[model samples]
Target: MNTINTHFRLSYQIQDEAFKLSQAGNCNLYVAISSRAMRLAVADVERNKFVALEDYELITVFTPLQIAEQLRLIADQSPILQEQRWLDVRISVSNQFFTLVPETLFDPTHQEDYLRLHSNLDPQQHVILYNRTFGLDAVNIFAIDGVIYRMAQSVFPERTVQFTHQTSSLIKSVLHQTDRNAGRVMHLFVERNYVTVLVVDENGLQFCNVFHYLSPEDFIYFVIFVMQEQKMNPEQETITAWGDITPDSSLFNMLKKYIRQVKFGKRPADVGYSYKFDDLFDHRYFELFSLHFCE
Candidate 1:
């Protein structure tokens, strides 16, 4: 523990009855990978209910391989890691290289071309993925380190196939919960060092991107910039938010100062939660909880 940066021990054992049900191989493992935090959760695949969850804050950043080794260690230590269920990996890396390409023209084999849209595509260090998260007739091409992907697979094996962008699933979660039958809306997911902004209407996803920030000033700047880029008026558009957000936080206070319609989002209505989870913040952990809606 001395060499590690910030290791917050995560422990949540389900009740005897819940443990028996989970042992039936009915739960799926959801892991959120990021430089800021690594969170794990178990959900009933059949009923889409949240069973238990835990997280770690990685204050001391390490090489991607080092982080992978840490994750393998975590998987090895968890009692439920051996369960025969799927492992869903959500990418929340700080640097995002993404582009929207038409589905008809998007070739999975040509994923690197789209990754090149943002920067010089790095094949050796980065692995690329072309995904159709939004229902639009287009696919998003993005990349993370190859080491991270392989490390996750090595831990979970054949059960780990679903890979997706953080913004994609969070956008879907927001849309699924919002009454989008009316008008265009915006949403934000704020973490300690990063902020993700998304705008959508009845049509589909309008804009999605992640920005890195060190101070509260930098945080609100990016949020407002996204709104302006999307031509969304803060007064008219509702901006629902979650993940490391609070009404009293400097970030939220700045958001409310400018955006009249700003408010905290809710958990997905379809999922059930254990009483143990009641102690966690409702405004946070939406990314971990929203993994249920990823599929």
Candidate 2:
């Protein structure tokens, strides 16, 4: 049997952070910095091992500056490495402050590239939209394909079909019956103050807007408005909340209270996907642990 070899290299300064590298192939190299001292040490290493001795076949230096001059020198001497895309140029900044920078500053084309990269990386990507307010808690919407599925407001390990299916049908009915073309709605995510809805079919994800509302009524109104703008009907749609609601002060009950409060009128229908929050991840653990010392 013949083995295939692959390598990936990444470099970052103390201020910079890399979320995750693409694992498209077998080889990966990641270099991150924590302090000014580390950055200086990296610079020294680049000068000696990278520049003077030329010890490695692939070398990428992550620095604050683009260093066009240094890149030119490296490209001239290290033709093979440059041809292999071994060099990555990046800026160094504090991790705390970097997130504060608007996406436009890093790259004007960040959104396009971000979506493309994510789509390529995870073809079966499931989107979850969550929002939390004082009286109105979190509403999570998971989008798979063009269909939006709702997750329970609270996170649970075990899958519950009642909330998931109900939420899916509600959104499906709303979108299908309404004038809004599902194809136009591109991406959706939850942000701090509001739910950021992106619609990018032919027009691209640029036309989408953030809907800001303090209450669930207002939030629903905003959804209606978007639907109406695209010509969706108000009467034809129903919004139902899903998740487990317990009989006692249990996982099921808590989720039930939340769903009833937001969805209105409808009672939670049991779909046989219920489980204790503690026993959600591994039910066998709960069972085994319970029987460990019992007679």
Candidate 3:
């Protein structure tokens, strides 16, 4: 069955043979929406494994209203999303307008002030929200277009919705996987037009930021620049990559040429996936899968 709305194309839809729409009450739903893409992942708590996923890629940059309309179309056709009741529903927004503040200095009332330092947010057009880091002493201040938030609310009006930023999901998953004894680890999460670089070490979250790149050269430049700024050696330390990249892709090849040890990352180990998922790359849909770890 093809479910391609004019605005967005369904790239892939995978589900376990045993997944049942009637049993959605036992499943948790995660929906991640960004300007360029939208994704859905379903985890079955009863089986401790992910049972379904639907990934969509947008042809062009979409405004908040356009994104919401596409989401509504997906909701109308996706069997997994058609169910009225689910055990849990979490939505994450991926955008450039976000900033992280240490919990010690975070004032809930000054969220807009904190975020303004990094990106501009129009109160009338965007909603300012924050999510506390799972294992770190920080708060991620981010914005979601009002149109998108309201659309999600309308789609799942019967269920309580939890909102978060894509960065929150990446940081939580990286922190959980970081081994204190391992010294320092850098992760590159490649999106359609941007890359999120995260640096964590024995001490704590050392650095996290996003950089937009237009070419493979620009992509590797940002990677190497961040390593230099952090005093890491590309010829020595290992970097793990996730999302929007294939092993034989030009992006991966560029990384390998510049860095001595580059490897693909796997999903969170705590959660399992159905055998059906084995056909896919473990590194793909990391931010969506990592949402499972969000509070």
Candidate 4:
């Protein structure tokens, strides 16, 4: 990982020798946004492979206007993001303003009502939206910061940018990666200040939620709590993890200290990645890369 100190620290960047700036029109751009970080990946559609990536870390928590400013700054300076000719652009907004409602109980006219039950929405500040979870029989009702949403739309003015919640991508990716015939398993995606826990069984998506924590102890408490609530035994049930974690990191160590079958996750098997990505941990960009599977 290479770090370039700037408005937002460039934590990691890698581009394949085959990637070409002029051919961006044939590529798909995937961007993941959060309070603590922003990341983008470029995939060459004709080749069906990811060709480049840029991961940026925010120094501090940012509000709507501040996040919009950061997005503007990054778009102005980023080599790949500045291009407006992408074949498609999909963005995953990572925030606590999303809730899942069973498809049978969902009503399109009541999107705001569904989200209001879980998040405090300001009509002027956030734009409420929804994404259908294929095969899961649920819809993810979410609110994206209006400033940030407009900035993202401005970033790619020519095409209709597809916006989705980060958990939506995680659900699509995890369900694709897990063995449907196998027993239930818990998947955790650890970000800077929060952890998203997803439990999948042979039937389909069982449980999915995010927990904020300030320390390693706080992190494990949520993990164990989810396990107990799902009737999963930490001693025997498998817990696979991905994102912002390393084998020697405090989070991983703590997970092992508690859960006996802790394991690191891998990249989505369906999408091909450039050899340039070999230097990265397989689990690091799971959500960003999984955007390929997002509708």
The lDDT leader among the candidates is: 4
- The positional error of residue 9 in candidate 2, measured at the CA in angstroms, is 32
lDDT string, candidate 3, 1-295, tens digits? 7454567789998989899888798989999998888899999988879999999887764578888888888788787777768889999998888998989999999999999899977889999999897888889999999989999998898899999999999989988887878888899999977999999899978989899899999999999999999999988999999999998999999999999999999989899998889988989999999999896
Q: List the residue pairs that clash in candidate 1.
A: none
RMSD of 1: 3.1
* Structural similarity to truth (TM-score) of each candidate: 0.87, 0.22, 0.96, 0.96
The count of backbone overlaps in candidate 2 is: 18
Tell me how candidate 1 scores on lDDT: 0.71
Number of clashing pairs per prediction, in order:
0, 18, 0, 0
Per residue, candidate 4 scores C-alpha lDDT tens digits across 1-295 of: 5243245778889999879989998999999999988999999989899999999887754577777778888887898888988989999998889999999999999999988988888998999989997558899999999999999999888889999999999999899889988788899999988999999999999998889899999999999999999999998988899999999999999999999988899998877999999988899999899899886
TM-score of 2: 0.22
lDDT of 4: 0.90
Q: After superposition, how far is residue 159 of candidate 2 from its true place, in Å?
A: 39
lDDT per residue as tens, model 2, 199-272: 33332232334455555455455555665675433344333222111234233243233333223222112211
- Comparing 1 and 4 on TM-score, the stronger one: 4
lDDT of each: 0.71, 0.25, 0.89, 0.90
Question: In candidate 4, which residue ranges exceed 4 Å CA deviation?
Answer: 1-6
Which parts of model 2 are misplaced by more than 4 Å? 1-187, 200-206, 234-295
